[model samples]
Target chain A: MGGMKKLINEPADVVSEALRGMGAAHPDRLKVDLENRIVYRKDAPRAGKVGLISGGGSGHEPMHGGFVGLGMLDAACAGEVFTSPVPDQMMAATKAVDTGAGVLHIVKNYTGDVMNFEMAAELAAADAGTEVLSVVTDDDVAVQDSLYTAGRRGVGVTVLLEKIVGAAAEEGRPLQEVADLAKRVNDNGRSMGMALTSCTVPAAGKPTFELAENEMELGIGIHGEPGRQRLPLAPAKEIAAMLVDPVLGDLPYQQGDSVIAFVNGMGGTPLLELYLMYNEVQQLLDRAGITVARSLVGNYITSLEMAGCSVTLLKVDDELVRLWDAPVNTPGLRWNA
Target chain B: MGVENFTNWLRDAASTLHENAAYLTELDSAIGDADHGSNMDRGFAAVVAVLDEVSFESVDELMKKAGMTLVSKVGGASGPLYGTFFLRFGTALAGAEITPATVGEALKAGVGGILARGKAELGDKTMYDAWAPALDAYDDAVAGGADLGGALAAAAEAAAKGRDATTPLVARKGRASYLGERSAGHQDPGATSTTLLLESAARTLA
Candidate 1:
C-alpha cells in the first residue's frame, strides 16, 4: 500500500494540481480549462469536424484526459478519483466543442459514467440545442454474465477505441458514423486484468483492499476495485495467459483473426515488466494462430498505483489498422504527428 | 413543515454524512470502489453551500436546487439516483400543502424516481432496499393517523431495518454487482447512507 507516500501536496488537491501540471506540460497541443476540469485541444471546435469527447474518473490518468489532442479527443472531462464527471462539466464540454458537425460522446458503460453522460447529452441537446451522440464501451471480459444488469466494464479497449474512432472523426465523418465506429471498436474488443497490489486513492489515503505477498487478484478493473478472484502470484507467462485466455474466449477470436494487441500497465507496473508481459502475450497469440496487426504496451490506462496489467485484444479490419496507425499528438500517446 | 425545515434537513444530512464519511467509505471499500462516503459528503456539502447562498420561496425550489447540486457534485450512479429522488420529491411537493399525507406522497414520488432511474428492484441490495421499506412504513404510519414526526420516525426505523437486511443478499445492480456472490457479506453503503439521511429527516423535518 502507498499509504501517504504519494507525491501530492494534498489529497483534496490531487486532481486539480495534476490538471494544472498537464496544462503546463502540454501548452502547444492542449488547453485545459481548470475551472471545469476539462482538457481541450489547443485549437478546438474545428469548424466542420465532428467533436469527440470522453471522460470518466480522474485516477485513470492519461486516459480520457491525456488522450485529448489532435486526431484524438477534442475534449476530455475529469472527475474525482474513481467517480464519474458530473453532468454540468460534460454538458459544458459538449457545448464548447460542438462545431455544427455535432459531437460524439464516448462513454464507458459504468453506471455512473452512463448516467452522467446521459444527463449531459439531454442537457446539451435541450438547453444548448447541440446535437450529441454517445457510444458506450463495455468490453471487460471479467463481467462475463451478460444477464447481470451492471454490465461489462470499459477497460483498455477504451484507449484503442478513442484513437481509432478519433481518426474517423478527424476525417470529417458525421456524428452517427463516428459513433458507429466507436461502437464497432467496442464490439470487436475485449479486456481482462489482474492486480498484484491494491491501488490507494489519494483521497481515500489507503489501499482499497488487502492482498498478501503471494496473492494476486484476477479480473480487476481500473477503478481500484479488488479483482473477482484471488490466486497465488505466478510468473509473467502464466499471468499473461490468465488475462489473454478470457479475452480471447469472450471475443472468441478464431484461429485466423488479426488483432491489435494491447498489454496495459496498471500505473504501478514498470515498463520492463510490461514488455515481458507483452512478449508472453505475443507468444500466446501466435500459438493460438491469431495474427498481431499492431501492439501497444505501456501504462496507457491505469488505476492509481495498482501493480497490475490488463490485456486488450481488438479484432481489426484494414480500416481499423490504418486508423490505429493514424497521426495523433496527445500528452500520453503520440506517433508520427 | 415549511421550506425552512426542509433546508435544515439538508444541513443536518450534510453534517451527519461528514461525520460518518470514513465509516461509510469503509463499508463501500468492502464491496465497492470505496467512494460512497466522500461522494455523499461532497454532495451534501454542496447542497448546504447552495442553501447558504440562496433562500427558497417553496419546498420545490429548495429541493430542486439540492437535487441539482447533488447531481452536479456527486458523480456516480448515486448522483443520478439520489438526484432524481430529490428532484421528483421536490417536483411532487410543488404547490401542494405540507402535511403528513403530502410529505408521504412526496417521499413516494422521490423513491419512485430512484426506482425508475436506477432500474433496481426491491431486493437488489441497493439503497432501494432501504427506501422500499421506508416508503411502506411511512405510508403505513401515516394511514394509522400518525403525525409527521411519528411517521418519519417509523420510516427511519424501517430504513434502518432494510439497511441491515442488505448484508446477506447478492447485489444485482451498481458496481457491487460485479462481485456477484462475493457481495453478499458486506452491507450496502448506499443503504446505510439512505438510512442515515432518513434518520436525519426524522430528527429535523418534523
Candidate 2:
C-alpha cells in the first residue's frame, strides 16, 4: 500500500488487459494473439521479407511489442511482468511471422530470455524447417557480471538496434544480413542506467525493492534489479555524467566517432527531466569530441513506472544512419515515409 | 511407493508452496523480481485443479499434465524450470511402476533437466544449490540400501542445508546475480522453494 499507485485492476489480468487495450487502440496496425500472448504486425510474414522478432517481460512498454510494425519487429512475445517470455510463446511468434526468407530473433541478454529464445529457435527449426538466427544485446555496463547472474544485461541500446535493424529487414535484407546488422549494433552500442525509484510488479502488488528518497541505484537493469552501486542522489548533470562516462569509456568511443545518442526514461519520469538529462548528455558528448548524428529522447524502453533514465551510445556509419532515418510506423515509435 | 503416493507428494508440494509463498516472495524481493512465490503458487493451484478433474492411468501422465500446466500458467523462469523438471521426471518413469530405484532415477532426471534449462552449476546460488546436494544425498542413501522414505528424508535434510548455504555466496546466475556483492546474505528464493519441494517429498512420497 505504501508504494506508487498503479492503475491496474486484478493483478493477474494486467498483461492480458493491457494487450487488449493495445489491440483495441491499434487494430489496423497490430494483431494480438491473446492465448499465446504474442503481438504481431497486421501484415506479418511479408512474402519475401525477413521476419524480425523480439520480446521479453511486459512492464517495459513500447519495447518488443510497441516496436512491431512496417519497419520494426514482425512479432513480439510478452511474458508476465518482469519475467522472460516462455519458449512456447516465442515458438508461436516465430512460426506466425516466418516468411520463406526465415526469421531473426533480437534477444536481450538476460538468462531467461536467452534460454527461452534458444529453445524456441530450436523448436522452430525442428518442427517447421524455419531457419532462425539470433542476436543477443548486452549493452548495460553497470555489472559486467552480477547477481541477476549472467553477462551484462541488454538495456537501452536494444531500442536503437531494433529500429536500425528493423529498417534493414523492412528493406528485404536476408536473414543472415539482418542478423549481422543486429549484432553489429549491439557490439558498437553501450548503455548504462540508474533508477531513482523502484517499480512494482502487478501480481506482487508492491514495490520490488525499496530505495531511500535520497539514494539512487546506478547501473540498473530493465527489471529493477539493484544496480552496481547505490549512492546519494545527484544533480541531472552528474547523473548524466555517471551514466555517460562508463558507456563512453567501456566502448572507448573515439573523438571523431559519429553516434546515435539515446536518452530513455524508465516509465515514471517526465519529459521535462528527460530533456534536461539529454541536454547534459549532449554537452558531455561534445566535450568528448563525439558527434551525435541522431538523437532519440523518450520512454521507448522502460521499467514499469520506475523513475529514472538510461543513456545508450551507438557508434554508427553511413548505412546505420540511413537506416535510422527510415520510415517506422508503430504505436510506440512512428516516422514519416 | 505407488501412483497414489506420487499424487500425494504433488498435493503436499502444492500445499507447502501455498503456505510459504510469502516467504519466497520476501526472499525474492531482496534481490529478484519478487514473484517467485505468487508464480509457484498459481502454477501449483492449476496443477491441483487438473489433478482433481482427471483420473490418470499412470503417474507419468499426471506429472506431464502438471508440467504442461506450469509451463502455460506460471509465465516466468520458474514455469519452464519447474515444468521441465516434472516433464522429464515423468518421462523417465513412463509406463513403468514407481519403485524406490525408479523414484531416485526420476528425481535424477528432473534435477538434470533443471540444470540444463537454468544452466547453473554448484555454488551459483540458485535452486541448483539445493537440488544438487539433495540429489547426491538421495543417491547416496539409495546406494546404502535405505528405504524410499529414508532416502527421501535424507534428501530433504540435505536440501535444507543447501538452501541455508546459499546465503553469503555471490550469485553467478539468475536475477539475484545482478546485485553482485550485495546479493550475499539474502537466501535465494528458488533455493527456498526447492527446499519446500524436497520437504514435501519427504513428508508424503513414502
Candidate 3:
C-alpha cells in the first residue's frame, strides 16, 4: 500500500472504533449513539433552542463531530471514510436533536450528502412533523460548474458558518433566522484549497491519487479529488497567495471590508506550516486593505491525511464578529466560558 | 423463471462481484473515491448471508430484503443507488408470476428508480450509460418474442458495449465529473459494475 501508515486495527472498524474513542475521551461533553453513528451534545435538544446538525464523510476530524457542543452543532452524523452518511442515520439524529423549536441541517455541497440529507429531511418531516431547514455551504471557488460538475463545493467556510450559526441558535434564534444567518455566512464566504499529497481511505488501503514530489494540486476538494489545476510545488508565500487571490477575487472583498480569515489544514499538515501559511495569508490580506476582524488557523476540516490547506474569507459585519467571539466549548475549539 | 432461479442469480451476483472487486476498485481509483468494488462486494456478501438465513415466498420479498441489506451495509453513493434499484425492481414485481416480459418491466422500473435517485441522464458517463441501453435491448428482445434467457443475454451484451463506450466521454455527473476533461479516457466504475450485474443475470437468471 503506497500511503501513510494508519493506526487502525482493521479498515472496516475505523469509524466505529474512532467513535468509541471519542465517546470515552469526552464523556461529559458529548454522547455517542453507536447504533445510529451520531455524536450528540451531552445535553442535546435544549428546550426552545434550534438544534444544529452537520455531517459528512469520516476523515475530517474535529469538523462536524469535534465542533459539537456548547455553541456549535447539537449533533453530527458520521459516515464511513469519504462517504456520505445514510439517510436513516441523519433522520435519527434529526429527531433526537429537535427541541420542538426546529432543527437545521448544515449540509456540504456534495451530491451524495445533498441527496441523503434531503431524504432524511423528508422522512423526519413525515414521521415526526419536525420542522427542518437546511443550508448547503458551497464556498470553494476552485471549481464552479465547469470543473466540479456539481456547482461549487463547500470547504473551509463550513467551520466558520457552524460556529457563527451555532451562536445564533444558542441565543434562542428561531430555525428560520438561524438558517438565514448560515446562508449569509455561506454567501459572503469564498474558499480555495490545494493539496501537496493525496490522502488514503482506509478500506481502499491506498491513497486516492498520487502526486509527484515536485508537484501540487491547486483548488482541491476535501475528498482528495484532483483539483482544478496542478502546478510545481511553491513556497508558503506563493501557495498562500494562490489560495487567497481566488478567494478574494471571487467574492471581490474590497478595501475596508471586515472579514474573518480562516486558514485550515488538511489532516496531515502540521500547525507550524499552517502558521507559516497564515502569516503569508495575513500579509496578502493586509496588502489588499481588507481588515481581518476575526481569524482562525487550524485543522478544522480535513481530507484524511492529505497534506494541504484551504483559505476561507467571509465578509462580516459587527454582528458576525460578535458571534465569532462568543464562548464556544468543544473538543476541537474552545474559548472563555 | 421461478424463485429458485432468482435465488441462484443473487448467489451468482455475489460471486461475480467478489471476483471483480479489485477491478471495480481499480477503475474507481481513476475517476472516483476507489470504493465501488469493496462497497458492492461487502453489500452482496451481506445479501448472500441474508439469502442463506431465511426463506422467502416471493421474488419481491427476496429482492427487497437484499435491497435493504445493501442500503444498510454499503456506505457510499452506490449503496443508495443500487439499493434503490433493487428495491424498486422488487416492488414492481410484487405478487406477480415470474415471466420474461415482467423481468423486462422490473428492470425498467429499477433503472428508473436510479434515475430518480442519482438524477443522472444519458451520456453522463455513469451507470445510467449502461443501464439505459441494456434496458432498451432487453425490451427489444422481449418484444421480438424472446424468452427470459434470450432477453437477458441481449441485455448483458448491450451493457458490456455501453460500459466500453463510457471511455473517451467526459463525465457530467458523480465524483468523476470533477475532473473535467481529465475524466475522459477512463472507464467508469459504476458502468463496469452495472455490466457485471447484467452478465450475472444473463448467466444465472436463465
DockQ of each: 0.80, 0.64, 0.59
Q: Write the per-residue lDDT of candidate 2 for residues A1-337, one digit (tens) a residue.
A: 4754778888889999999999889998999999999999999879999989999988999898999898999999998888888888988888888878999999998877887788788889999999999999989888774444688889898999999999999998998999989999999999999999988887777788889989999989888667878899999999999999999999889999999999999999999999999999999999999999999999988999999999999999999999999999999999974
Docking class of 1: medium
Best by TM-score: 1
Scored by lDDT, the top model is 1
Ranking by DockQ: 1, 2, 3
Evaluate model 3: give its TM-score: 0.97
Q: For residues B1-206, what per-residue lDDT tens digits would candidate 3 score against the true structure?
A: 77788899999999999999988988988888777888889889999999888999899988888887887777677888888899999998998888998888899899988999888888889999999999999999999999898999999999999999999898888888777788999999999999999999999987
Off by over 4 Å in 1: none
* Angstrom error at residue B28, model 1: 0.8
Off by over 4 Å in 2: A1-4, A146-148
What's the lDDT for residue A91 in model 1? Answer: 93
**Which 10 residues in a row give candidate 2 chain B its minimum summed lDDT?**
B68-77
Could you tell me the TM-score of candidate 1? 0.99
- Residue pairs with backbone overlap in model 2: A146-B177, A147-B176, A147-B177, A147-B178, A147-B179, A148-B174, A148-B175, A148-B176, A148-B177, A148-B178
> Which window of 10 residues has the lowest lDDT sum in candidate 1 chain A?
A1-10
CAPRI quality level assigned to candidate 2 from its DockQ score? medium
